[model samples]
Target: MLSKASTARVVIDLDVPGPAISRHLYGHFAEHLGRCIYGGFYVGEDSELPNEGGIRLDVVEALRALAIPNLRWPGGCFADEYHWQDGIGPKADRPSMVNTHWGNVEENNHFGTHEFLALCELLGAEPYVNGNVGSGTVREMSEWVEYLTRDGDSPMVRLRKANGRDEPWRVPFWGIGNEAWGCGGNQRAEAYADLARQYATFLKDHGDNKLYKIAAGAGDDDLRWTEALLKAVSCLGCGREPKNIFQAISFHYYTVAGTWEHKGSATDFGLDDYYRTIAKAQDIERVIRAHSSLMDAYDPERKIGLVLDEWGTWWDVEPGTNPGFLYQQNAMRDALVASVHFDVFHRHAERLVMANIAQTVNVLQAMLLTDADSGALVRTPTYHVFEMNKGHHDAVSVPVHVIERPEAYAVDDHAMELVSASASVKDGRGLVSLSNLDPEAGLEVILDLRGVEVQGVVGRLLTASSPQAHNTPASLGAVAPVELPVNPASRGTLAVTLPPHSFATVTLTL
Candidate 1:
């Protein structure tokens, strides 16, 4: 933990570069829950808002600014119940179903495969489709892949052509299921692993499109589930080369300030609750390290990948909203949570391939919030964090060593570090992201940029007067970024003072 005035020394080794930080790590997720789909991204063909093919043009424009690399679609849990066939064809003639998983709301099937793909096209992002394993057949799963990626004549290809698409769309990522231990299906890990193998076996590649099949994996702290999956999939002692049954394994972890039944409020949190939230957010590093170790045990060469498909802060929905809608306010704390996660993510880039923040809009820790009545869009504080860290995408990860730091604060009996940061280099320039977790005090960070010639450094800072400060429709620029000055320290070091509960990114001209 850091005091009101503390200096932390961090060393960045530019020469000892780690793995390339996959651009897919900065991905977004759009599900069929609440306004995230209906009033969030899609406003119908007749809305007053600027739209292209019924997709919100402003949302597209805002996300494109972040250079969002990939998008996971059709679920958090909805993918299991979604039948791809029902969502395709004409919109008016499409059937409706009750969304039993979320709020028991009626799904009118307006946004489907074609609409989602169109949205991805508009945003210039790759689509990662999650298949239905809880209620659909293997043949159904196989044909959906064929319908989306297969070229030339086939049963599903003909059906896709008849439905209006003349050519196949390129889809690279496919998920077998979601949360098999809970909402996806209450199956054991071994049972789900066998099913994953069977389902992935038929996900055929067509033309130039190859699929990277990801199996729905363990929940947070479910090490036995991960070990069970490794045992079911590993072919080490079979005396033959191992086959890629699934390209990656996915797990989910959400930072919550309280228990599941009583998750703390999004905006009205006290100082103790805030510190507890930070401690919970930092715990993801332990989860990632544990999973990575198990993966290394099964495949020493690191052939398989680990995907944190679902992550972010989960708070009690704003008062008066539907509990299942999961609508919450974004604050500076959410931004710090994101910054801490990215710093941890940069450290594990070797095995961590991709991650999608729990949602993109109108849900828990959303980037954008939409007003259904007025069709107004508001960018959240979390959005600015993604924008500031965009330079990290696909850049070589440079190890950040904390030579000296503040004493860890005790939050709910857990040690919480106040200063967190990560560095990456690309195209002869370097980007260093820094975050101060203190809510009331500022900290001076000294950067020891090693193995690189220092030329110049420019910085952008994101913070507000209060930790609870956020952006609303009336005040969209409330918590945005401003120019931050980087000063020349003694020797070849660079110095910058980060305000409490703030995030900053410095560009190094090397």
Candidate 2:
């Protein structure tokens, strides 16, 4: 039988200061795919469901609860095919087109730029717009930015006013294209970089709305893509300008347990699959390190930020949903994945300015799932993981050193410490987030607090009966967070036991 107990030691020092974890690190992505837009966020202004100007009330409430910092929208691949004109104007006059990249369903163009910006306003999140670089022209993208950000009486501005939105919306983050290595254009790095510059040239800033242009970066560990794109942009020779034309470069990575064609089921996995997924999730650090090294070589001062614009687990489509919809059930495995990734992000918070999980709703590793027919929504285990980790947003990183571990969890000759953790200080307190990756063993962690006085500690944990435990519309509370009793600090050490396949967050008043 496998060992049932694991021991780990964490050492946190208060004097050492690290990067300020950008709240944008907790950002979300909303693609015009699956039910993410229509059934998930938009229920139509006339629908019977509770809504605020066509946006789902429950979904907005949940996102607001997390204090979601930013939202990227309009496409993953759809941005390339999307015409800004098609999504503006009266809903009755708007055109419908086939979403060839996702489901091949007809997109009525109802939930267009206006709807997305309105939703962002509702949730109080920043809007990150991905412009079309594949099938769209410089003029189209330029005018789209003008329509949204320009308050002057230009043609686009007039059109915006005619559509009932008089004032311009501030869109600070803009993508030249998404996945130029694949979906956006299927172009080589050098070629896409050239197109990105051309499009970004005309995407001008209006008033105080300065655009943070993001170049389409590599997919996974493709270092060549990073080198070529950054080199191409560096050749621009912006002699006296303080800012690079591309304010940031994006990277996309998705964790898949099996082959892309036959990724294993979301909820039907055994210990082997579970271990493999954890191993895959751990690759984020290596990917970031490798790509960051390349960024350092080209732009040493780190003027351009690395945006992990798209990420999360992409498993087999949940049993019967439309395969193209990319829908899946998020379970305990997903919660662990979230914890592991957030820890990695926190450690590298300096260079990595922003990241958006693959999707925000009714899709890959979604925080919330909405029933199409019933309009009922369920918060997945991943959602609670975000909730529990929210304290780290905009907080200063408190360096955590894992002092020792009793044993390693090994699978197929690869081993990982049973407990993964990170620490940060916000305001006057300290926040520590931990995850126990061992499927069958609970981890007892003894934290050695040095250079600080701990007045008190409170804990919250998210765990379930099994790795497959998840929430559905019929059972919304299966994977929610509960208060975990905190052990009193004794002689500068605090002890806590993490249940198997669990995540916990402890806040210390210092």
Candidate 3:
């Protein structure tokens, strides 16, 4: 621990009491891709496993605990070819189709629209459905909304009544399409933006749906696509542009070993690989800045939102598992990446509205992995970051300034800080969240809390025994968080030593 400089006053503004932040940013995505749905979230009706409406009960219970804010369904590239109608009605009578993108496996239309929305209900999560635009028509997309959210007597409305849902499910957020740059049809940005206006106009007409249509956007950190989409969509009309047209502008980024095509091994990697992957993961801030700058230039009031719809670490599949399944082990590395993303999002919370990780179960960077055969399930280390950061959700972003020794990672032309922190005050409690990304060297942080101590403080640490340590179904509790011992509260300052490659949080209720 280092010596205290001055007692810096820490202030928290509770008037920033925003609508309890939607937990969806800390949400999960589930696609028919890999075993995310059929074998992951769903257990067959005939199976011996315990299930509610053929959906795995254990997986549901695990996800429910995480308080999954929102669950994105039928996505990645899978949403491109998905037909809402094929998934409704009698299970046996439904036609089976091939999942062209994921595993090249057959997808029985059994666990369709109704089942997905039902699962969201069981987990107490809001439904965020991705509409098919690459292969499906405007009419098709509109009808899906009507079927899921429209009531009364129309063709789509009548179908919803017959499909066992007499009332609308209140599906709030809708993706106009998924990844239009590549697997999602690869349309040029200008063309996609033009199509976005038309699709949003049609889908927005559904009664009481009030669907917040998210336009399909740039892949990874491509700022050009963000600029093109913003410019094109803004030209719709003065009142119809940034402020009214699109509710959110989504960007997708997956941090892996190398290039877009050949992602390296997921499980068996070294520390260098781990550091490099996270270094790349942290580049999302640059992408957000580029997009935000462009949006600010056009609409300084900042009406349109930024959404990180697809994110997380993509690596080679686990041994004895299908590569397409994205079935990799979750470790401290994944947890740190999750922490990095949340910290970045908090910095951009005003503009970065909603974010859903790549997937929930048995997919790339999943929060929960399930094995139905053994009735086994484990919450990934990434899950801990979400649990730890739940305190910051929807809370005001209190400004934090770091003046102590600041180390930087040096590359050819860029550098990122080794110490990062953000603070927020909620319920009259001051919470300081810190992330130390240095691979080595513990940081001696001198916290100045002058004129802010009325009571006590709490500290929780999420540090791994070894960088390579991971949690499996058997050792699910291995890489958990620990409470650090604290000395008596100082008059106005406290000294704390943070271990390398870790994330920690401190709370002060004054």
Which ten contiguous residues of candidate 3 have the minimum total lDDT?
Answer: 5-14
The TM-score values for the models, in the order shown, are: 0.98, 0.97, 0.92
Give the C-alpha miss distance for residue 496 in model 1, angstroms: 0.6
Better of 1 and 2 by lDDT: 1
lDDT of 2: 0.89
Top TM-score: which candidate number?
1
Q: What is the C-alpha lDDT profile of model 3 across 36-68, one tens digit per residue? A: 898889988887888988998988887776778
Alpha carbon RMSD to native, model 2: 2.2
Query: 71, model 3: CA deviation in Å?
Result: 1.1
Model 1 ranges with Cα > 4 A deviation: 1-5, 235-241
TM-score of 3: 0.92
lDDT of 1 by residue, 124-205 (tens): 9999999999999999999999999998999999999998999999999999989999999999988998999999999999
Error of 2 at 93 (Å): 0.3
Candidate 3 residue 271 Cα shift, in angstroms, is 3.4
Task: Summarize candidate 2's per-residue lDDT along 1-510 as a digit string, tens digits.
Answer: 123347787899966899989999899999989999999999899989889878999899999999999999987999999998998888999999999999999989999999999999999999999999989889999999999999979999999999999899999999998898788888988888788778888989998999999998989999998887777656334432224677888899899989999889889999899988998898799999999988777777778899999989999998778999999999999999999999999998989999998899998999999988777889999999999888999999988998777577676667766778999997899999999888998878888988888898999999999999999989999999999877854799988888899999999999
